[model samples]
Target: MKSKLKMKDEILEYTHKEIENIKESFCKEYEHKIQAVIEEKDKEIHAMQKKFKDLNEENTENKNEIAKLGKMLEDANKKIKKRDMEMYILLDENKKQKEKAAKKMNKVNELLNNLQKEYTDNIP
Candidate 1:
């Protein structure tokens, strides 16, 4: 009876120690998995932040390019306006010269007619 009791006590103690070791191992594995998940999330957050920064830089560059194009367009429009003004001035000057030439031609024709009449009277 004593031997039987001792054997039963020894078996119970071994079972308790095995259970404690299994619990410790499960806790360690759970902590390891949680840590790994946290690290992965941190990496994802960093990647998203970098992408956002890159997009902001691209947006800034686009805005600058648009402003530059707008300025160039304004300058070109000014040049066109100046060229149009010059063309109008030249056309007006040409019109005035034509009017002066027409007046001179009329005066010359009248003088020629008068001279012909005088020559005809003298011959008779």
Candidate 2:
């Protein structure tokens, strides 16, 4: 009976050692998996940041182009207004010259009528 007890004791000791070794190995594997997941998340975050920066640059360029077009439209409108003013001045000048010409024509007609009356009286 003493021999059987000694064999059973040795078996129990061996089982305990095996259980401790399995626990250590499982902990190491769990830590390695957690580190791998962290690395993958870091890479995804970096990619997202780069994409956001590129979109900001594109938005700025579009705003600058719109401003340039607005300035060009303003300049074109100014030119149109200046041309309209010049046309009005030219039309006013033409109207004044027509009035002067009409006055000169009336004077010439009166002189011819007076000459005809004098010649007819001298002949009688």
Best by TM-score: 1
Top-lDDT candidate index:
1
lDDT of 2 by residue, 3-120 (tens): 8899898888888888898998898899899889988988888898888899889889988988999998899889888888898898898888888877777777777777877878
Clashes of each: 0, 0
The local lDDT score (0 to 100) that residue 18 gets in candidate 2 is 86
TM-scores for candidates 1 onward, in order: 0.68, 0.56
- Compared with the true structure, the alpha-carbon lDDT of candidate 1 equals 0.94
Residue 109 accuracy (lDDT) in model 2:
72
Q: What are the per-model C-alpha RMSD values against the true structure?
A: 3.5, 4.7
